[model samples]
Target chain A: MALIEVEKEGKDMAGTQEKQPVRVRGFPFYPHFLLREVVVMCIVIGSILMLSSLFPAGLLKPADPFDTPSPIFPEWYYLYVFGFLKFWTFDVGPIPAKIIGVTLPMVVWYGLLIMVPFIDRNPSTELKDRKFAVGMGIVVLLGILYFTYYSIVNH
Target chain B: MNLPDMIYKWFDDRFKISELLPPIVKHPAPEKVTSNPLYCLGGTAFLCFLILAGSGIFLAFYYKPTPEEAYKSVEHIMTAVPMGSLIRSIHHWTANLMIAAVSLHMIRVYFMGAYKNPRELNWVVGVLLFLVATTFGFSGYLLPWDQLAFWATKIGTGIAGSIPVMGPYISLILLGGTDITADTMTRFYAIHVLILPAAIIVLLGVHFMMVRIQGISGRL
Candidate 1:
């Protein structure tokens, strides 16, 4: 009788252990994650297709090596760098202004960006808590915008 | 067994796709990121890349890499080929949008502090991807072989030439000479279509894998 009772207890323990839930980390990725992605992708692609049909890209005159166009600038994204070249014309002794202009912006931009993960020791992800970092981002954005505008107007 | 089951059993015995697909198909994504619009930027940028690839392949069918024929070929595509202008426009617009979307995605990641701890390496890969995308833009700009393309490239190469010590070498390597000639066009063409695409794809794969393993970062 005692042996049978012990066997029953063992079976009960095994059943309970088997019933313990597996710790699920997050939501199922298929229907939920994939559905959202599909929707966003559709919107993006549909808009691009619509825009392409509505307004086709223009082709300019063939390239001439001898003749340089007035107000020569790169695409809109590069306007900031072009404007930076024009703006930072002050010369330092020995070093050319062009090098300073180019190197300074490149260094500042990539330096801060690459250093962020290392320097930003704050574990918090809150915007209000990361005031300095957020402030710096806003300032850099405004600076780029201003330079881009300057390039457009001056050109 | 039924025909469908028989077919499945045959394939499952040979490939084991049924065993392989479940984990991938049912992979978990962080609950916080599922509903957020900000998290969608990366996906959006990737979509733009897909558009670029499809449209670029179409453009390549008619594009000529030589200086003499490059401009004329582009013009012909725009004016002559069926739906060519539309494809070209899509490619152009998609490139611009990809750059914009990638920039915004990086900014969002930064502000969200998604580049913390275990995710830092992916952040570096993201930065390299950004640089590669910008290079793609620069190289592709010259391929149109127009007045704007020519001058813009000259100025761009000039900027590289101004970079203190290695400036001259970098410019020389880019141009394949002192000036923008036939060689420069070929180099840009190769880099735009071949080198950049390969590098970006590999980096993107790494970036995606890291994201998958790490899951999404916690909400701010």
Candidate 2:
């Protein structure tokens, strides 16, 4: 060991030495490495352009304020909710829209959310141990599903 | 070979790795992950937004914003244009879905206490985005140029007028006068295409930047 150190010292003195300096790399401001997300955005934008090009300028009848189109509807996603509004006339009936649509679902979701950070006994990572989160997540999802079902059936 | 030669050879062969390079401290093995729920939800909502934008841009191509042409244009798109109804349906559906997804995402964030401390500002921005999204909905609703649009705008503008002080002025600004006319369509069009979208785009950028910086909230 003594001999080896002496030889290495001699080499350093002769300016035949190398040092491995520690350095840190920062996160990419432009992560071209994230090609997948960029590609997806590009493809979506391109498709919109393609569809717009395919659609002709003059397709439907002229605007008439007095005319009410058949099956008067907002867009489809809104159809379910709008359909719920149609039941507004049934206010004093079994289920109220405010309770079913707004208050109850909100309460359930918030209750579950509030219970999350406290409920998990073994939270290992930022990603893992979302059991409670997932549980609460299901409530919102189910509400959407139920709303959609109600909309379709009522219509 | 002598004893030392034999011993040296044996030790050399026994620990060939150390002869070449010193052994490193063993690192803990990383656990396998199945899915990232944040990415999944965010990606899904993003996909829905893409769908909405695509269908919307297409609708815009044939959409005449003037009161004279607006209703006629929608009818033309529905009847004459190929897949017009389908496109319109997808556009409308996706917009509603985006709103639904965004709302759920916010609730999820709130419940998880993801908006605590450093995230509180992001929460405020999220609220702003929601307001902008509602405005987008309101502006788009009046574009159809029918009895529904007319009456709905009347009610909506009336609601705006209840705000006191500037309320009536705001309602007038929204309707482009006292009534829903060609001017009203122009106002809604400007809002839907220009004002609301611009606000949403800017806020969305900030919202996403905040999320990325804060990282996903810790498991509860």
Candidate 3:
């Protein structure tokens, strides 16, 4: 009977805590937070303008379907996919190597990436607490860098 | 009240601007988030998106989407149209920078484990946004219709077409037919100008709305 009373008291305390107004601990968004965003925006805009004035966007000669350009490259971001297609040359079981190449990076990798938050059930946010996730991220980063380099070099 | 205050008051009287703004303008930003340089990455990406949208609209005014007119129009924009080259260049550079910012932002999110628990859906939305951003890049460069653009897309679509079950259909839809043609050019233009922008705006709305609702997941 004593234990039940104590549990009810604890539940009541928890309920009141939940009911109380949450004092959001931080500075206001206006002026304090937004001032920094504005500064960053100015910097980003200035750099973009400077780059535009200097480099200017390039336009190659008119496309000729018959003459495929040598050393063709996709947009820089897609280079890893391009690189991977070039890197993987062997097949597994029934699926052809090319099929695996396309599916692995394009399909399978994306599935894995999208599933990250769900897969990493670790409740901790600290860097040291989530070693495996951090390690996998590093490996993926390095692999992408390596593949990007490979695409450029091998091209 | 001053001149600006009078204008604000005009709106406030009509629309209850005071009531509307407090949620957004006076909302608390986490102390750690404000101090941390890494937190700036997402905002940087958003700024780039704004720049891209502005410059893109300007470029679209001059850009023609047909096979015959596409390259010619781009050439005209580069050499003939007033401030066309500069606007186009700004669009180009901002597009690249936005992608970089998004990538770095995602990396930061991943390492920090900000995507756990209630934030999982936002992370998925983020990854989808990244995919959409890259698709924006892929579909975009093809609009210029340069030799590099043509061949690069051929390789890109060729690669896409090689996927297992849905490969052929995806490539066919993207390319419009067997190869990149007039149909493909117009289709890509429609996609770059219409489809992607609409999709991005919706996704961004959800992304920002979720952030505001959940607040920043960054460790305090």
Q: Write model 2 residue lDDT over A66-91, tens digit each, in one string.
A: 66454444434444444444443434
Cα deviation of B79, candidate 2, in Å: 1.5
Clashing pairs in 1: none
Reference-based lDDT, each prediction: 0.85, 0.59, 0.88
Candidate 3 on A1-155: residue-level lDDT in tens?
53354344444434544677545556567766898888888888899999989999999999999997788988899898888988999988887888988998899999999999989999999999889999999999999999999999999
Residue-wise C-alpha lDDT for candidate 3, range B48-143, written one tens digit per residue:
888889988988888889889999999999899998899999999999999999999999999999999999999999999999999999999899
Instruction: Determine which window of 10 residues in candidate 2 chain B has minimal summed lDDT.
Output: B25-34
lDDT of 1 at B168: 88
In model 1, the runs with Cα more than 4 Å from the true position are A1-26, B1-7
- lDDT-wise, the better of 2 and 3 is 3
Candidate numbers sorted by DockQ from highest down: 3, 1, 2
Q: Pick the candidate with the highest DockQ.
A: 3
Compared with the true structure, what per-residue lDDT tens digits does model 2 show for residues B1-220? Answer: 9998888788888877533431111111111101223333444466776676677889989999987778888988888999897788666655665676677777666555566655667777776776677677778878877666666566556545544356678878888788778888888998988787678778879977876666545434
**RMSD to the hidden true structure, all candidates:** 7.1, 15.5, 7.1
